[model samples]
Target: MKKLVSLLLVLLVFTGTASAADLSPDVRSAILVDAASGKILYQENIDTPMPPASMTKMMTEYLVLEAIKDKTITWDDIVTTSDYGFFLGRYGGSRVFLNEKERRTVRELYEAMAIYSANDATAMLAEHIASTETAFVELMNEKGQELGMKDSNFITSTGLPRNILSDYAPPISLGEQVMSARDAAILARELINTFPEALKIASTPKAVFRQGEDDQVEMINWNWMLPGLWYELEGVDGLKTGYTEAAGNCFTGTAKRGNIRLISVVMGAKSKEHRFKATKELLEYGFEAFTVEKIAKKGDTIKGYEKTKVLKGKKLEVPVEVAEDISLMVKRDSKIEKVVSLTTVEAPVKKGQVIGSVAFDSESDYLREKDKQDTEINMVAVEEIEKASLIIRLFRGIKNFFLGLF
Candidate 1:
């Protein structure tokens, strides 16, 4: 039987050589990605949109972070749990047991939502940001569109909203915010990439969410794959876990091994073990199968052009180099489709000019190719050494003082 199976596998490969697609039977949908670049190294059914379960929390949590960063809110500010927060807890939604008028700080609420996946806390947070649950949902979807989550829409802050009262009591209607595994992966990547500071808070094993002069709650994070797992795992931090009848076990996992960070998304998994095993397999494959190659250095002048003009600067010309060393790993010997758009950057110019962009396509995605976007991070600006005029320096000081004044 073993020999026959091996022969059958070989025949199947030859039979479908033209299609040249690989998929694992274990997971219903999945994607393995590079966290820094948002590149999909491997995917299976990633674009077949599905209910994202609690993975929806990633978006909700980030919006809260954004609120805090913008000073529209503060972590120490009290979050009053109103009808919305209490209603969610009473109706089978997860909660930190926060009651109406009871308040938790923004920091504590963040821990409750991101670390413990608390439904009441998440709902209350949504209410805090936009003043109403409906408003928060709109904000969630708006941010979703901005982040390229084309398949998602948020009807509730928590993934547990029920339509059963209307007779459509579908077994856990995934997320009102629907998303494909691939888009889900992209969203997860943005959270970690944009707010790396969130990690220090995300990896906590236990959190005291309802601390105050009265009543309290303790939340042990549900993402067991991080601190609880025993493997060569390290730098494996947050994300979220979700489940509803419609959406099976789901997870968005992020980890950093040295300088490299990887994210894995799995939806519709059979069991808890299936998610852990599949994630481990995909990450291990990525770690061993690829490497980063730096093809150019930042501020590298164009090889052929000796110098370029600097606009409005004291210097007439500055040496130009490849803005950055474009580096990406290919399968040990896999040929990559390399295209560099160096022509678009016509800098009058700067040392660190984005003369153009480089993209290497290793393969094509079968899913909607129309929407796939590239993640090309820009390099820092290189300084022009020429000094500013004395008059320019004096004027700069005057401008700084006036700008600093309210």
Candidate 2:
């Protein structure tokens, strides 16, 4: 009996504490994810299609950034308000209230949409990209397709009620802007993963901008997770909050600790209280349930990557690395299983360009080394090794050969 009890105790200890339950009782849907791994850590009704109200703003923000990156627009570029922008502002949608003939810089517009959830700013910003809100909504859908937001559609820049003349008769206000919590989380993850620079703006507690009338409007960030109102979490940054009578309140939050960043999305919560509570629960569950163990430090060699030959390119075999810090947040004491693949071009691997995803299964270590606990793996770029002399390479090869032979 004593031995059996000891064995049972050991088994319980090895299994790690049971993860906190899916505590959300209020929301219609929700998802908690590991942003780095794109793994669904916890989910309930994640794939179900539902109306995505203002949560659609995350995609709008993403499209705006894509346009900026493509040089289709600039921060200082001015967008004149349109009839749509005017109507929305006039009708009391959250707005910067730029007049139909008035102009505001793209930076001001982007912030207004992102920080203040301003519909007029969004419409004007969309016009700057696609010359019309309708066209920008198309661009938003196109980009959503590229990002695999399979269940989503953008009917308007402001996510306002717009009557559309469908195959039926008179124009009807869109009954729904469909999206899945998982798809929404995926888009939010892409926005942060692609343009980390936006964090500097999104995380701000407040932003001040002058409208076309030179009115200095104080745009207090609508995100509730900033300094004054947040828990003692570090590296929390800007994402967007969304709400509509149909969608309820939703929030997509992204935070970084050390080098590990994560995105969380909670939707369909009954009230602002549920929204905030559920989000905090997701973040806490993510951070507390698993441990991010760093395995390989920067400048460390990635085994097997050196031996893989690059088929063709201007350079030779490029060093394929886990460019960012590779962390495994696993059940304590559970091993991590990682499979690395090279997703680079068909030939010479360059310094950067998604080589491949390192598939980590069931929370395992990224890299295992003697004495040192597996932390995170920082990648070494190919350019750094490109400069090594032939003699040094040959000598290293000879040493490795001898070690293997022995």
Candidate 3:
């Protein structure tokens, strides 16, 4: 019986390992994450940086949106094509065939870049914002660092290879624009969270550029998983795609179903079809295997630490409750452990003031170190607690002193 049991255990271990290996996407690097909680569900070689191709435009898009939000520029602002923008628009890898010194509104250029991935439009926007593409490259790197993209290097706003730009290329020493799958996903998350309206353009399947003009062009989005596209995965929406000799094919995709939204990145696929295929696999696995579970609701009191002692308050103890709802994306069958730390507060405490914190740890392997901070929720005062009268405080102090002596 012992020998038979040992053999069964060995088989189970081997099968489990093989199952995990089989689920890894067939790409150079990939990662899937819950958009709300930033929990990593699936990851493979996510930190290895490689050419990101046109996906670099995401940073340009972010900066443009930032400018608009800051009121430094507006969608209706007109931008004239610079010498570099004109040259790149005429001869760059992907373009809308912009004429030298041609003028277009920020809205038009933005649509061209976001929906069509037009390299020239991207370059024009960069120049318009920073007075030069080289200066814009500095802003991109600065923003990347702020976003905690540890393995990313932005050499071009359009993600075009430096050689393609020839003399127009920024004077940066880096050879090319590169980002790891994790960084790409991080950018995607930040972009959508910070500027959700971006999806309005990114999800657009088709549009006309310079409509009804001699140089008009029809722009079709490269993301195939969007609704009404070839792959047409339900709930799949706004994102970006890229391809280059060095980067192969790459995609950052996002989708939402019910209350759960997921972001996925696939880099270095052999073909366009393969990139989307890998993304679909990652999304399906995430949707099927995990769910966002709400462990505590706003105002729910922590069980054992429901009341915290308050010094010099009308009431010696004040009730405390969670400040925000705590939710986490966890495996379907996994168990969760709740750990809490409570603290005392001085009197004159206001309702909603933080007094403690609660953390929920799950028995799953998908959690990452960065996500640790997100799993905790603040505990706050459930109601106001004003300081007691001086006479009452003195009497209470004397009573406590005598009690301590006993």
Candidate 4:
């Protein structure tokens, strides 16, 4: 009995140590989330706003992509370097030197910004779109609000500290820009979903800024976890990294293994190595501990919600099923509860008309309250329902009236 008690104490101590290590990452703030569902898998101090450093450029990247999508600009459009661009090239923290009045295609500048973290190129793209970095910052703030990045503030397009910008800084009095880890994950998830093409430029490990030009420079991606890089991880691709005295070392990284894509943020790490290491730990934990389970198949009716009432239809009701496959990234071996929300529809209902939604509620501690709604999937009609004739409608109204009285 004495020996057994001693062995039990040893096991308890070992289990406690492992739990503590799993909970602690070597960073001031970190978060992990499912990119598809926005379900949070892990988070620590994620809501506290902190300087995001060049991760601010992710927002700049989004706006640039938005401009392209809206036809406000094109990849081949030539933009002349503004005086501000020249000034930043001279003083910006990470830059590809630009001569005043120098001409480059939007694609050129975008690649520089995406792959090299070129502040000059980033600022030039902003000026081309909004005519001034300060005005461009306004657009950033507006989009931030639209995207629900409530904890973010953008002061410079380049994410450079105000001191580095010298007199070229935005006149806003709101102080330095900061974003919470949760907000950063949100932005990253939106970026990939809205502009998946952005990943093409982001994943390029190396490219020449101006091939065969007199002053060409080799641009290497700062996100070193990408393939063929020093800390290469399989499926690691396009994302952003940041560092400043104020922000420490930071990274907003994403990876896709099979059908599961995960977004992770690590902020205020001791060094670049530590940041990537922390991110790798988060990614591995997510991939190993959770899985993308298809809880509801497309066109399959939910058990308790097989049919919904419809007014003015040839048939009084129509069969409804999920419009698309409902997959949730949930803990392995965990049971999921299906929560269905439905609405009544008037007929002339199309075959795939969305009339309701189905969302999963997990009892797992890893999921957060705000992200619960992210798992919701549209429930749609399985077949068309034509409008009822006037006589049929009158009969149905009388029947409903009698049913209500009874």
- Name the weakest run of 10 consecutive residues (lDDT summed) in model 2: 1-10
For all candidates in order, the CA lDDT equals 0.66, 0.66, 0.83, 0.84
Best by lDDT, which number?
A: 4
Candidate 4 structure quality by residue, lDDT tens digits, 211-252: 899999899899999998988887899699999999999999
Q: For model 2, how many clashes?
A: 14
> What is candidate 4's CA lDDT for residue 228?
86
The C-alpha TM-scores of every prediction are 0.73, 0.70, 0.86, 0.82
User: Top TM-score: which candidate number?
Assistant: 3
State in Å the error of residue 315, model 3.
5.2
**Ten residues in a row with the worst lDDT in model 1?**
4-13
Clashes of each: 8, 14, 0, 0
lDDT, candidate 2, 27-80, per-residue tens: 788787777667666778887888776677788788888878988888899778
lDDT of 2 at 60: 79
Q: Give the winner by lDDT: 3 or 4.
A: 4
User: What's the distance in Å from true for residue 217, model 3?
Assistant: 1.7
Report residue 1 deviation for candidate 3 (angstroms).
Answer: 58
> If ranked by lDDT, best first, what sequence of candidates would result?
4, 3, 1, 2
Alpha-carbon runs more than 4 Å astray in model 1:
1-25, 164-176, 211-216, 229-232, 298-321, 340-406
Give the candidates in order of TM-score, highest first: 3, 4, 1, 2
